[model samples]
Target: MNKKGMAASLLTAVMLVSAGCGGSDTAGTGDKGGADSGSASGPKKVVFWHAMGGANTKVVDQLVADYNASQDKIKVEAVFQGSYDDLLSKLKASMGTKEGPSVVQMYEIGSRFMIDSKMVTPMQNFIDADKYDLTQLEPNITGYYTFNDKLFSMPFNTSNPVLYYNKDLFKAAGLDPEKPPATYEEFQKAAEAISKTGKATGGNFAIYGWFMEQFFANQGAEYINNGNGRKELATQSLVNSEAGVQTLTWWKNMVDSKAMNNLGRKTDDSKKAFSAGQVGMILDSTAALKGLVDSSKGKFEVGTGFLPKPANAKDGGVVVGGASLWIMNDRADDEQKATWDFIKFLTSPKEQAYWHINTGYFPITKKAYDEQSVKDNMKNFPQFQTAVDQLHQTKLNTATQGAVMGVFPEARQIVEGAIEEVLNNKKSPKDALDAAAKDISSKIEKYNKTVK
Candidate 1:
């Protein structure tokens, strides 16, 4: 049976289970009429669960400390909850218990699941109640979190994909390091030249589906059907479209020609290859800028450019990738209000500026860029400006806003598997992608039915 048919067959069974789960309409609102109605007697304690570690953990800790120090009404206890996948697993397991945090940080791909779970207060609820002005936020950043005309969560730590290259390698290959490729054709030419030098692989293969998504966006192509799952519940995958096939074919040819290193599906391996000067170029999230710069320090100069597109394409843009803060509906009204307050404090211009400077994540609030600290930081690390520019230049559309579906994470894995098959020569690009798309369609269909 086709994916839609399978979904239809399972809908009744899925609805039976879904009907038993509780739903929450008040996402960020506590029991109070508004955020201001939080307990007046003492500071309300709010627990925050997140997946940041290493340097990111330190930054988050400092932000929490600063927030705590700045206010006595809401004391936020930030807890590290392993990786994004780990956090999602724990969150699912804790839904039936009182152990879930009041505010949770969820990765972008989990947005659909979070909304369907009905376990949190939507930020729109709080915004409407408090008359909060969302104009201060960058539209492109907020666009990803906005679903069905409602902003579900507060965007935080947002990043975009960019091409990172070694300036030294570019110059050695007799190419202008400053003039990074603006199109895939140029990129291929540059990659070929860099490979001929034998000093490094021309490009590093990205194991994740993120690069593929970016390429699709660059081509103004949707990753899934139903307007990238924005117009309606998506029933199919579009990863086997001509644009996708072209992208995978290009990648396959690059790998076969030895212009790009096939580092498998491990992002760390690709990152290591690039940082060790074994590769000249790589496509990675802007969030890796700080670490990439630090690691490449004293070794070579690091440069960044917008993700390349087809030279003939008329329009291109990138989707925002990162986590956002959501307030759980299980908390007291005051606690929910407290969580919202903490979220506001974190997204404030000063705090966002601090975050943008310390961590490589892009500032969501527009005013954050106006801060002197952010300005000076950009001056020091000019590479960050490329990301900022790329975001501003992005044309907002369903394809660029990113796909929204409960099974997005699974869909990503399916795409990765398809990429692996093509890279390993087990299947042609079209065949591999067609199979993956079918699998994703089945998963999406099942998820949509299960949730409804």
Candidate 2:
């Protein structure tokens, strides 16, 4: 058969399997609880599994409750399933069973794995069927979730990394509070000055692997081969490339020069240090802006800046760092549709505005900015405008779109281990990155083989 014919046949088979997963259900049957309808007296139900914890959990619960109350045709039950890693693992364990979630919220790095599993109904399918307008959403956010010219998931809460600094510390160190560092050298200088002045340690960055990936993108460097895995399955890891070496070397030098503190792997620890005025600057997600602002309220002033890059680099930007919502294929058509409805409601401009102010995550829809609440939020918390400006100024490219691999979660852990190895003097920058690249490449090969 020709390529087009083969593609059509594969799609038919996939659809058939998906249909079969729902079991037999008579159309227009209200007595049975399958795709056709719910109980004889109520609406269809959708089980949504998510990973929002702590104070965020209450916000999620409220959203779910509001969604449930808004309509009687569909009732969504949102369940908090621990961290992102835990949620993905639990989904894996429940696959091919009758107890799986109808919809799941997965992190950005899990995209390849979710697609490879073939257990999700692509959001593009619903968009096409419903004639949904994708233009209203943030182009960069949708770009991150689009693969093979298809949007696999609906972007719910999207964010990118930013530089968080203490304005008081900057002023005390004889530096301009308004001028946050934009490049590596400037950041290094500021850090050293702050540390030397006894105001605070220059900075404290959590040894999070996401930072390395962001750094790579900021340099217009790909993390994996095959167009950052968007063109095709990535067969190699580029964690040892020039950009990677430069990133690690710079980080290690900061630690060695006492300009930055290596605050282990927990971002919370670094956040705490900064909040306590023990650290002048730290790197964190835009989602943390609200919390930092609230925590630093009267004690000190907080400032945000774009993620720093090398001085000479001019063509790169940070990748999206949050999660998206996916529809599970095993769910009944009614359940899936109800889930999609809930998703649409959640991403609506008004809801997005509510989510943006209540949480630090920026709205995924451009229309959300027009909401009076969001405008007031920007006015009240101008530091958030820095992240918004940085996001809009970014240039879309293969590097900035981010790498996709079935083994991305594992790859992140491997990169984080390499960072530790370099910082602790156990290995040179080149050697550590070379080792990480080799390890991730092997894992990628294994993951590709399993998926095939």
Candidate 3:
């Protein structure tokens, strides 16, 4: 069963569910231009559910308001649906019913599940229908959402992991403040140097599964077989591979050396430790660049660097990390089209610029880089350039494109547990990863069978 090859037929299944089981297309407007003229009561409504929180939520609300103000045919009502996991669970519960949102935002790992569920329209259809120019968008970002040569969702908030270091601490440790570590060996030495300063610990990486995946990609290692699941459904997890074991071994060594602290699994906790000057460096998403800079404004100068790789690694790149917009197919044609229009407005160069500056996410549209605001932002926060450079430098390979599995979220949890076990000295890196890989492979096998 080739998953990507099933898209066209599954697209029809999605539409049938929308028109037959869900609702009829009452609005006559077929094109993307405008919706039907509503009665004197009000405009047609398009419901949108998302998982953006904190400062990002405000930005989302403002964007939604801007879109509504820009048009009168359709009124887009935005609803915050908690975290990404929560939003996905809610969408699952709302499937086949009118209660689901016309548009929803889902995390990157949910791509396989979304495609398999057949509950949403392929963004490719809208692109083909409207002659949308996808070339205008960032290819690295779009590559993640593209499956079976078709884009299933609109790449919205995109990001990658980077190393954040405290320059003040670096200088205090008699290290060059301008040069951040680029390899695991260099990272260990720098961590030891920073710790020797007695002012802050060397570094701390949250026991995060995403970081594990990134490290595997950093070494040009596939996280799963079958071209990281892009070529076909993945039946196994390669978390026990040499790259995976090397990553865990390096991480466990750092913790054992007391150069880096094991701060549990919460990225926020690790971020706070860095902000409070308790840790000199940390690994975090590019989307946190803005908040981290603000938190360390008066305390220390923050510097960014590419995610560390093994010293021997010759080829690898960071995978795109973030969420994308999905259009629920179980909605009226007018509402779905309206959702498309809103997505277009959001992804436009201008909006992407605003989003990039405000949220610290990569502007999915390339033209956004030409925006004056973006140029000024680049100048003000030069550390952001590291992420942009890393993204651009990435090669379009399966490892960099990232792995796709319906059980990705669960797999991440399993990997995190393995990390915890190794860091706690309860299990060897190979032993722990072997167990985690076995568990994830079992889940993958189950998922593939169920989907088939």
Compared with the true structure, all predictions reach lDDT values of 0.81, 0.83, 0.83
Q: In model 1, which range of ten residues has the least summed lDDT?
A: 17-26
Q: Model 1 misses residue 393 by how many Å?
A: 0.3
Which ranges in model 2 have alpha carbons more than 4 Å from their true place?
1-37
What TM-score against the true fold does each predicted structure earn? 0.90, 0.91, 0.90
Backbone Cα, N, C clashes tallied per candidate: 5, 0, 0
Give a tens-digit lDDT track for model 1, residues 5-47: 3333432222121100001111121121112223568778888
134-234, model 2: which lDDT tens digit per residue? 99998888888999889999987788899999999999899999999999999999999999988689998898888899999999999999999999999
Ranking by lDDT: 3, 2, 1
**TM value for model 3:** 0.90
Q: What would the C-alpha RMSD of candidate 2 be, to one decimal place?
A: 7.3
RMSD of each: 6.8, 7.3, 7.1
